[model samples]
Target: MPNNNQVLFVKTPSASSIKGNMFLYERKNEKQSWKLADSFPVTVGRSGLAKDAHSVIPLNDNLPVKQEGDGKSPSGIFKLWKVFSYHNLQNLKMPFVQVDTNFYCVDDVNSRYYNQLILADTAIKDFNSFEHMKLSSNGYEYGVWVLYNSNPAIAGNGSCIFLHVWRDENTPTSGCTAMAKENMLKLIHWLDEKKNPVLLQVVEE
Candidate 1:
């Protein structure tokens, strides 16, 4: 149960998949009321140098840009940017674009969409040579988009950025953390224009 006036803290399983490790806390009241929702399965990120990056977008709400590399999840603190959902997913031709629904990969020194947020209305053809850039579609049905650092010049390692699913009921994420689809939807419903820039804490196990 996420509200506009609450900050969520997801405690990952330090070891095994146990219950009650995940709890919700109130940011304003400083309330100690913690509850456990044990209806979610957790998935860790692929291990490797790719996994070195923390703070990743959750799954379930989005699709992988392209299945390549190690496919490792990131770990770090970030903020929620916006939610992107399309109506005509099937009819949409290649590079289906929209406003606030598309993200340009800036990892590459070249590429028009590099290090820039592409509008959904723009035409994005040419995605064949993006080893350094990754244009992510869909805002995210669940999970918050972390604003790791406002200074884009210092943030964004240029790797994995997609709406991923939660790993387990209570456990930290491999690279990006996750929860159940229900919880994710709950968060999405409560998210608004003001409560953005969510601060996430991805603890290392």
Candidate 2:
């Protein structure tokens, strides 16, 4: 609920649709009205939308709640923490992490590093499952970390959610939001940490 000047608003067709539209909005200050900066197509989880920690309680209690390995993208407003790229980026106002083979986002709920991005060579191998930040498929070549289920990182909740490059426009992601590489690059470059950027994912009622 922090005052955010930059927001990436993603709207899915329904709670079960994998396809969606993303609109980037910005404002000069909290009092100013948001202005649309950009718009593009994007894909979401294969299964669809699910309420996560950041979600507002819906009127219908039957809506799905997000959990680990749900194949559903979290639906809510969340802070965009940082950007990660295979190569170092310049002129980006947001915090950036240049990932290598050793970078991992741990998903092992039993491990202390659950829901965290760590250096594999330096951290204890307590986690049995994780996603390499550097992928041969290049889906993660450029990405932004979506801070969902991260403040407290509850066990069994979702983890490692991100906005990243997609394999193609027709392909849906496991859980994270994905788009074309060019759009991803544009988003990364436009993001400013000082603006308090956030992501708002939802399914229109």
Candidate 3:
């Protein structure tokens, strides 16, 4: 049902594997086959994959379901939201925001801003836990927001999911997809807003 023509597909060996492969595909239209644009080695959550609200595939009931603090990545089709970077890059094809100290992603389930990105100084400070969008490490230096649990943002399903730079192939994220910095920058430059890009995470068939 998704009308997207551009897709970033991620495939893991199983629901528990931290290692995965990411492929970028694009099509001229709904009737056209998706052409492979690029591929890269990637890593997923430490705890692995889980069914999410946006999941479109038939999933086994025994599979784990995503939850807050579960250290699992959501498995499903998700719209690629805005791109966030430590520096303001030019000529990007997707909507972008420059991250600073004021930016925070609220994760407190009880707060009204739960599962939403907000400016620390402008929003109500009711949340006790959050991730600073601008981190000391380069993991978040350049990234794309993965729109999971965001449409209606269920209290504790998950939050702050993104496609970011991984520490290394051996390092798994808390609950996001990660790859090489160069690949991430390649993705950032390649994504076209008009193409309606989406992210698809799935266990390999």
Model 2 Cα lDDT, one tens digit per residue, 1-205: 4578999999998898989999999998988998999999999999988888546544235558889999999998888888999998999999999999999999998989988999999999998999999999889999999999987899889899999999998899989999999999999999999899999898876
Instruction: Give model 3's clash tally.
Output: 0
Whole-structure CA lDDT of model 1: 0.37
lDDT of each: 0.37, 0.91, 0.91
lDDT of 1 by residue, 1-205 (tens): 2433344443333322222222343333224453332233444444311322333544222222221243444334344554433332223212222323354433333444433444434636534333211215222333333443234433234433433345454443434445566765554454444433243333334
Over the stretch 4-44, how does candidate 3's per-residue lDDT look in tens digits? 88999999999999999999999988998889999999999
Q: Can you give the lDDT of residue 110 in candidate 1? A: 40
Ranking by lDDT: 3, 2, 1
Cα TM-score of candidate 1: 0.48
Write the number of the candidate with greater lDDT, choosing between 2 and 3. 3
Q: How accurate is candidate 3 locally (lDDT)?
A: 0.91
Model 3 scores worst on lDDT over the 10 consecutive residues at 53-62
Worst lDDT run of 10 residues, candidate 1, spans 59-68
> What local lDDT does model 1 show for residue 74?
34
